[model samples]
Target: MRAHGDFSRTADRTPGMTVLTVDLVHHPAHSVLTLHGELDFASSDRVPPLIDAVVKAGRRRLVVDTVGLTFCDSRGLRALIHAERALAALGGGMELVNVHGRLLRLLDITGLTGVLAITTGPGAGQAVRK
Candidate 1:
């Protein structure tokens, strides 16, 4: 199965360019937010609202499926970090799944690997459809 979504820049001013697609999957044990497309400065604006919505929905555990992610920049990483922190503060947790290639390398190089949970394949967390 395949899913698609799009986010664009508004009148708000920002440098750089990015687009984010988020797919929410509901599972028995947890919720999965699958991200696709490029996540950078321009697109980063969408991260905060989405994160807020997830947290407000009272989801205690979340798995972010990054398998479809094509690009991630410092801004994207920062957004992830914010989400991680938010989840922790809410007495929940978040994990990143299916991260590989340059993105994995970037996480390692930036010392973010220690901060976020990275899963390479299935079984990292519960799977659900939404």
Candidate 2:
């Protein structure tokens, strides 16, 4: 796997705030994006452009590893949905991995668990459609 640049963004230097970092790893089968820190409104907007670039580069399947993700707000969820849609538009798909805790609960509460592909480990999860 070849690594791409790290995309880290900070909305502020306020105390108790975590910076969002996105690490991209490219493989023959797919591209893996590992997300760290918060995925709130402050950092959500940074994801789509990267996804678009990946698609433009001819990579279709995407795997988002959320093990390092600490928190995600509604806007963050919207960004993820957008990613799925973006990939789906190209006959590709996005999978969320290492999901647990509040984020997992949020997906369940919002009924997104059924809409988005998710797994606790690599190669897990089914492709469920709306």
Candidate 3:
């Protein structure tokens, strides 16, 4: 179903550019987190709990759609790592889909690309709807 419940701020940080927002889309078997704006220091901290909630609610998979993510830093990486670890411990896991090239490079540099499941199927970002 289509839902617009944001877990973070939606106010524009700049004139026309929003700084960050974390929205949730609940699916039957999974949860889709649509992240917009920068997933840096100010925003990264808000991620892990959401991931935990999905797993806690008995969802086996969580997909982080970063296509709308404009920027991410080490803290963002840490957040993803934390979520991954938590899910693994719970016998569940996460998918980082539609990740951009630059972000992929960051994960590669940090040796996280190997630990996390990344998917880039055709129109993966559009997967949020179905």
Candidate 4:
């Protein structure tokens, strides 16, 4: 557990570079990881450690809030899948919320709409297949 919030630090970046910022928010029932910026190859690797930290802190259920997520490539998708599997292996679960636009379409096109537990729209909670 690295404090109660902002689990990952803001990495130093050069001009015109995009970076991912992951914030940890603990809810009564689960932990929420808020992702911001592009989730491409360079930033995808940042997710796993945070997931591990959350699990290490005794959290099982995790909700990945993509409200601020601007982009997600295949590697980003892989990171998400890995997180879901890692949680499931520990008798836990993970879900995505606020997914829309290209990311949603990618999931749908890749058949991940059925593979990953995701919820869309305002105030989403319950998981639904696309």
- Highest TM-score: which candidate? 2
lDDT tens per residue, model 3, 1-130: 3445444454535555447677777788888888878787767778877876686667877888988887888888888888888878878788899987788788888888788988766877655666
Stretches of candidate 1 off by over 4 Å are 1-4, 10-18, 121-130
* lDDT of predicted model 4: 0.79
Clashes of each: 1, 0, 0, 0
| TM per prediction | 0.80, 0.85, 0.80, 0.82
Instruction: Give the TM-score comparing model 4 with the true structure, all chains together.
Output: 0.82
**Tens digit of lDDT per residue, candidate 1, span 7-101?**
75545434563457887754555667888777778677777776676766667677888877888899989988998898888888888988888
Number of backbone clashes in candidate 2? 0
Q: Write the per-residue lDDT of candidate 2 for residues 26-120, one digit (tens) a residue.
A: 66667888888989877888898879777866789988888889999999999999999999999999999889899999999999999998897
| lDDT tens readout by residue for model 4, 1-130 | 2233332234644566556777786665688887877787777787888888878878898888887788889999999999999999999989999898888999999999898988887667442211
TM-score-superior candidate, 3 or 4:
4
Better-scoring candidate (TM-score), 1 or 4? 4
Candidate-wise lDDT, in order: 0.75, 0.81, 0.77, 0.79
- Of 1 and 2, the candidate ahead on lDDT is 2
